[model samples]
Target: MTTSTTDSSTPAPGAAASTDERIAVVNPATGLQIGSAPVFDAAAVAELAARGRAAQPGWEAMGFDGRALVLRRMQQWMSDHADELLEILQAETGRVFEDSVLELAYPLTALGHWARNAEKYLRPQKAAASSPFVLSRRLRSYYRPYGLVGIIAPWNFPITIGFGDSIPALAAGNAVILKPSEITPLSIEVIRRGLEECGMPEGVFQIATGAGATGAAVVDVVDMVMFTGSTATGRKVGAQAAQRLIPASLELGGKDPMIVLADANLERAANLAVFGATVNSGQVCLSTERFYVEEAVYDEFVSRVVAKVSALRQGVPVAPGSVDVGAIITADQLEVIDAQVRDAVAKGARVLVGGQPVRGVTGRFYEPTVLVDVDHTMACMTDETFGPLLPIMKVADADEAVRLANDTRYGLAATIVTRDRARGAELAGRIDAGTVSVNDMLTHCFALGLPMGGVKTSGIGTRHGAAGIRKFCATKAVLVAPSFPNADIHFYPANEKVSPLLLAAVTGLYGTASRVARATPRALATARRLRRELGR
Candidate 1:
């Protein structure tokens, strides 16, 4: 990875000078060049992978305790340098200060969580045999590291998703090569430097900074791959990993829905809907994109949502509280947001608040938008609109709300809002998503003990909890028999007497009630035959 530096002559954001082998980094809010990173080719990535492979053994040999120490130090380092890290995050992604703070805070929690729990989660476990025939045998299982792991992170939450995912892979004793999205790659470099300062061994954790080809190279060289991106890109990554026969875990696209029942607190439901849909400029995979509210309260809910969205402060994030919402991460994303809003309007949806890009702003930004009269026929309701656009549809009842919620191909997450907790939870269970939050939204992702992942086109496999760390490992099962006869009855003498005894013993152990009592005598006779065969 090249060191970040500002150059006035460098091309604007999104313009990579491939001939010069560099990707120009830009501050999305200002649309100005912030720095440039080397566009590493396949050969460079292979060399980095080789170095990581060589260092992995030593890192793994350090044991969980040693690794945890380094991780703990990193936590302190992050705390000490939170402001500096937050700055890089803000500059590259153009997210609000509060959103950037989340990107910083998540890794701190993840570092501590994975450091403290990895050994316990990956520890060997004794297995019990189900059959009486294997009672004398001991069975155990343990995990082994995959040696090297590749993580391809999207641009939205560079630190939270990129470094956060690496924590568990590192804890599981694997070397990590993170290929952060070129759009927002600067923040990860800061993390790599912090890890080195915290006594992380060289080559154990490295960043491969470049575009899609760079990510592909990392996937080609690593033992396993974890990807966070669009469903289209995830499919390619999944296919590549499959061709290599390596394990792949994907966190893909989502068109998360919010269901508001008639019994819901209208104020609270509307507040959550606006925040969940517009936070981080609505770039989150788990963000609520579409809403289904009970028709009885639909007009009131839409009114409240529009009021809140209109009150939002959209601007460049200069500091904490500088803006309630920040610039869109890329120009391309701005277009997507505009296109979706237009498509919804064309399909007879009414824009209750914002409906287009903010004017008089040099930075790429979309207005925090709210739409009513939306249905499954509109792209904004059915497709992934990863921007600050919320389109709500009226449902006749909870059943209709559920039907609309499950209407999407993406099943990453969904939210239910109701005053009756039990009813909300029941409806949550019926929603087809990997995670369903009742009376809440987007908070389940922070609970490190709970697993998070998408289902269907949203993603495959999971992150967090035991599945997170264990996915970076290979399981080994060990079975031992402490005692055995010199020539076991089943082992090779081809004895007719031994076969008859074995059959009788099996009959006594598992036969029906009618024959069980009578088979005991036959079992006793078999025991005598076994003793004679053993020369006892």
Candidate 2:
């Protein structure tokens, strides 16, 4: 694929030359030329910002209903055009068509749900007034939009992560400026313009096509930012957002773990383990980066997993009803995966199964590789390879599995394949992650009810559940006085007695609730005796 040339030379559509048209766009799956996504220069960026600023007012005025209607219909259109979306996604990112839909479809589906329920969710709720004397008063809390939001999205699962990250901000009434990766820009436009056609006002959903520089500009200017990418870039975005104190929700990186318990259904776990580690060519934030298997079942599990990995269909992911294990998004990413695999081998790690790419001239395809004897010290074990590379290690039991799982600086998501639901939940609780799946890998994301985010280096804040849907708006507290004399209790000299009395009353209740519940036997007996004596 060759990049289509477009004029991004003029800034503001009227200024002198700004960005010289740059770079060709190559289709990842087939290496064919697709149309170009313009790389905006400073002038074009100014225009985009200006348009976004202009659109914000009309969009905000749409209130909740109008915006919801548009999003609701947009969700329908997305469902209807699911095939087209899958095709575009596969072409642009080398993700298998089925996995592509799995990633994109659900997040887009969330649009309708968010639109329908966001009004209630985003609206302010009543908070305690605290002072009982002013019980007649009313207080409520609500959120406000963060104006413009900057989104820097990655190429892997481009549509899913991209839309999932931005939709909440839009629902919250913030104008969004999206920066899709240089590698997968076309699909983003498909997304950007889709919202446009859904009748979302211009500027409200402004799309600026560019690479890192354009992305940096958004960080320099917008109200808040949501980013999904490598840990390195996430750190940079975090730093930039912090420098401006512009509050960012970062889905940085993950070395997510998947555990197979001794009690786990070895068949199911093996099947999922192979599919989970290699889905999207393992270029997934939540993919199983590390596998911990109980010693009793370790050998059998490893054997079955290797056999399944060897069975994955590695090829061009676009043919009809193709058996698909997706390709890595780029040659550079291919190199990264290759180096990690080669290094691991050199450093005494054994490749239990496939290591090199299969016979193909298509996209960046790598055979599903399984590695054993991997320790935490190796970069392959610690960092995200974002390819179909699974490193397995043996553990004595589930306890050790849990320890090894939590042993990373990153904890975006984890999956455990065990038949014991209660044990899975218990283990999940002990695990430090935003989302955990029992008996499957990456399936939890399909659950709209589940919130998606991470702990440690995974990310800050959340998305996908109620917390995510509500993060788009500004929460504000409103208080109204009872218009009575006691409402002015804080006026000080107006009521010295009342202030202390009220303070004591509130403090005493709080103290009694928290401190007196487990009072010493002596104290309880004394109180009982005193109560009896007083009654007499």
Q: What TM-score would every model get versus the actual structure?
A: 0.93, 0.88
Q: Model 2, range 1-536, lDDT digits (tens) per residue?
A: 12333322112233223365754666766777665656776666666776777778788788889888888878977887777676666677766667776877666777877787777777778876444443556788878787888888898866777777777788878888777787877666666667878888766776666788888887887888888888788889999999998788888888888889999899999888877788778887778888999999999999898888877787776464585686667898888888888888888899878888756475567878899998887778887888889899999989898998999888888998888999899999999888888887776666666688889988887776677766655567787875557535456566755555444444444456555446554545544443443342
Per-candidate Cα lDDT values, in order, are: 0.86, 0.76
Which tens-of-lDDT digit does each residue in 1-536 have in candidate 1?
A: 11245532222222223335777888777777777777766877787788888889999999999999999999999999997888777878888889988777789999999999999999999986655445568889999999999999999998899999999999999999888888988778888888989998888988877899989999999999999999999999999999999999999999999999999999999899999999999999889999988889998998898889989998888768878998888888899899988998998999888898988867898999988888788889888889999888888999988988887789999999999999988888898999999988888878889899988899999888899899999999998886656655567767876787677666645566565555557676664454444344
Flag regions of model 2 displaced more than 4 Å: 1-18, 132-134, 358-362, 490-536
RMSD of each: 4.6, 5.4
* Deviation of model 1 at 377, angstroms: 0.8
Output the TM-score of candidate 1: 0.93
